[model samples]
Target: MALIGRISLDVVARPQEPTAKKRCLDEPQPDTLKRAKFSDEDYDANKRLRKFQESWKVTYPWVTHEAYDDDQKPGLMFCATCRAYPDLADKSSALYVGCSNMRVDPLKKHEFSSAHIKATNKKTKDTMTMKERSELATNSPIVKATKRCMQITMNILVVMFNTVYSLAKKCKPLSDFETHMELHVKNKKDIGGDYMDIGTNYHNEKRAKEFLMSIGEQLRVTKTRLIEKVRFLTVLADGSTDSSMTEQYTVLVRYVSEGYPVTTLASIEDIENANAFGVKNGIENGLNKIGITDSSKIVSVNFDGAAVMMGCKSGVSALMKEKNPRIVLIHCVAHKLELGVLDAVRSIDYLLKFEDIVKSIYKFYARSTKRRRDLQAFADILESELLHYGDVKTVRWVASKARALRAIQQNLFATLGHLEHAASANKTEESGKAKKLLHEMKSARFVKYLHLMMDYLEIITATSKKFQQNKLLIMEVPDIIKSTTDELTLMIEEPGHQTSTFYDHYDPETGDFTDHGDHVMKLSGQRLTTYEEDNDKTTLLKQTVKYLEVRFMDFNEKPLKCFDAFNLNKWPTNDTELVKHGRDDIKELTQHYIDILTDTEHSSMLREWTIMKNLLRKKKTGINCHDLYCELLQTQPADIQNILTLVNIMVSISPSTAECERQFSAMKLIKSCRR
Candidate 1:
């Protein structure tokens, strides 16, 4: 006989031969010895087993639980204690069965069975002790809540840290952070819960300073990681006098990190001496502080062409060159370009006089309180906002000139009105000065010169800005210089540009160019007519073109030929000098990077060069070295590694020390007069 527990009627039984012997009641069940198959009846019975414990656990506390709905069958509920032993299933009463109706009180009857007591004693003897269970329950909730609280605190700290670092980078005062925290605290109270204490912990300057230091450490660690991978580096430094009368040198490091050129500020330190040795020692100290010790790893050094910095025997570039003969020395391209522009304009007499006239106009108003007030009165009368007249600064070559011209252009009518009124009044010493300015402003030559120079300055200013970009590449600058010079040439040679759109104050409603005729006609009783150009305009254009040719000739020199070799628009032909420079001169500098390629890659390099010549001829403009390298890498992968490596190495030589100039700007904000 077999116990048929939760057996479905639909189950098919295997045929068995009839036996003569009668089975005894004490025989073990065949199904229980082997695993049972799943049936619909078992699934129905499993549901009943779960509901039984929920309603009857309190009525029979000694009856322990078991899981049902297992893989072999729908499953069964059994007494926990009785199921612990193996032989009880063969008894007249087995204590385990599938749960059905809770109303039958099956668990109550099973609790009193004799087999239950033995199994319960065996299982409890080996289970967890009462003290151990109690300790686990007590500590689990506390550990979870502590972790949640710490996570919230760390999140708040991170937010405060980012806030302080952002404000510090912009040179904002730390008191602003306190005010921000106060606002947050008030908002938190209004929201009705004390969920976090972020405002309380970081609402002061001391904490803000600590956060700023932590951010600095994070940047240092990141730079260190990048430096560890660099095969070579270039160190750039320049000296400037800050507002505090202290000599400061800003140090920058240029290196290849992950196949791209990156220039990052290493440090800014104050020095007593402002010579080559002072800057050299200061840079060495900064490099040491940043953990860069190997001088041999420095492949190049760049600085402005100042005598103190670019001197052949004693300059920083020359001194570094002495230590490592393989190292390249480059004067800052932006500084050289600015000097070229200055040299170009200085050769012409009228252009020099034009610059003086612009400076005089700025000073006439800025140096006199009465003239400034009179100019403001005229501006107000015309319903225009106050104008900022800028002074000429020696260091800010392009921007200062451009700004002064733009100011005069934007407020031409009001300026002319103020000068004419002052000339008519003639009540003070400034009136006499204003009378002279009135005559100059009304001159036909001055008007034409203003238009000509303003247009020229606009081009120079735009190119100068590109030069000052923080990560300018050396190969990219020659194109900008060529384009500027070409544009300047076009302005000189191209016809009818004089009658083209000139910078003038425009009427918002009418969309026509407005002039000082109405204001001057009323004050001087004479109507101002349009100015006609004289021969000075032709002379000005000629001198500008001549100066550009003389100054930009250096970029075409043999030593700098490598910088121009890859230009798509100006590809060198098979001239002996060009081929020699492209092969021998460039190879001398790029040999270190070329050594990194495998034999197969070196073969690929020659193939890529031949392909580039054809491709570049088709696409003359806007194809940079990086673009050419990418095309080569796609078409021929096996040959591109050496060229790619060389391009990355060459680009790491920064074209300007503008980053050093920026540090001085920051120093002014940090050590302002109030500080």
Candidate 2:
């Protein structure tokens, strides 16, 4: 009974000569069966599965068939390029492997996909050699456009750099960048095309400041690199109060570059303290900023003769020497001369009073425009040009004092005429003051003091100017001091040119004024005895000469005196004298800078020195040390490197801190109250 029931169920499920609708309802269709078979993992050998079509290659060139060993095995479709380089193929795409979905839709979708397009390009690029690819890239329009854009950007940056550098050099405000850019765009259209629009972002003050900072940093880096290459340098520093009432320290470095001494500003920084420690720290910080960490490289330091700067036991100079025992301490020669002259003048009561009167006269005229115009009127009537009255101060420049004295002397008659008119015509307090000044100007004693001071300052002023030279060598300082002292010594017996003119107006024996034709100065005061006048003149001359001798006595001593060996003009004429000349001094110099020279170099220097002297004696050279060094460099010998280095060190020692003073002047101009 069970077999009969099973046979009946099987007969119901089976069908004879199946119709299309019955087959669709009861069994899978041929196409559906083929798709199902293709989806199977082991369907590659199935004949019922869909096969790759050759016609699809016409629609998709990348389409190709996967091969099988058996002819009856089903074929599969894939992207030939993606299959070749599988790394470039999209893993999510059926085309990465072999696709059995034989319809054209999947091939078309992959052909338009980003991955397939990327893969196609990579494959095409790979087929060519490196040189072929390079040529193709070089000729590509896209590459050309990219290069052009980069060039335009660089040109715009160059223009902006130049503009910022110009404005900074002129000390103009950076806010003017936009105005400058506009000017450039209008005048220099060809510099950068369409760069104006791009440069708008950089036209503001913020960007201009950044540009300036970048340029400054680049320049500083270049200067630091140059400083690092030098073996020896001199440090010049000074302290001052700026517009903001901040204690500012200005530092300058002097070194030899290309066989010439160059003095450049290292820094101008605000300091919380101005004592020795503070100043020393500031100098170290400035040197460190320029990459000079080795203090031993410092051959010398120049500063004013302030107690804190020049004190032997504890001062900036002493502190610097603690770091390198060989470092020489230089008291600024200009300041020394100035202090010496002023001290000598102040020692006498009459000259001290004369300075005060000169200052008062300058203030009286300088403060009043009305008085100045009156003075000018008097000057015009006298057929003389009115010179501006300059103030005299203790710490002021000798040149300024000279100018003030010159102005007063040239306009003395005119000033007296104005005062005479103001005192008599006007009845006011100013008139009263004017009368008092008139009385003082008409005194023979005041006139004599004025002429004497003018003569004295003239000699000192010339020496001060010489000391302020940028490349002034230590060897030249002694001669300057001697010449100045000699002139003052001569003035003790004979009066100066200006003073001699005054002597013409007076009787020497009686010390009384003589009436001279057309002389504007009619002296009216208690006449001095010949002994008193002669005593005043002699006292002033003798004191000035003595002060100079005592103050500049260091120039005749050790390390400084050794530099005189380099002064070719001082070399002895005879060979016997020449061979032995400066030998002790040269040894002293090498011993002074012993740390800077190696033992090998120290011994070689003497030999090189002898050779150099002989060579220079044979050659036509300038008498100055710098000129001689230049000649030595031109005919450089194999063993003279040490000698050349010593010469550079000698020349690098500046005679004064004038470079620092000049930098301060520039700083005042650049950072004024209005700025």
By lDDT, the best candidate is 2
Pairs clashing within candidate 1: 604-639
Q: How well is each residue in 391-462 modelled by candidate 1, as lDDT tens digits?
A: 445314465676777677667778888887877784887678878887776554565556666777787888
Candidate 1: C-alpha lDDT:
0.66
Global lDDT of each candidate: 0.66, 0.81
**Which regions in candidate 1 have their CA more than 4 angstroms from the true location?**
1-146, 193-195, 366-387, 391-396, 424-427, 470-472, 494-554, 571-638
What TM-score number comes out for model 2?
0.78
Q: Could you give candidate 2's per-residue lDDT for residues 597-624 as a string of tens digits?
A: 8887788888888887887786535366
User: What lDDT does candidate 2 reach at residue 285?
Assistant: 87
Q: Where's the lowest-lDDT run of ten residues in candidate 2?
A: 512-521
After superposition on all C-alphas, the RMSD of every candidate to the true structure, in Å, is 16.8, 14.6
Q: Poorest 10 consecutive residues of model 1 by lDDT?
A: 521-530
Candidate 2: misplaced stretches above 4 Å? 1-84, 87-147, 150-157, 173-201, 204-206, 390-397, 425-427, 505-519, 528-533, 620-623, 631-636
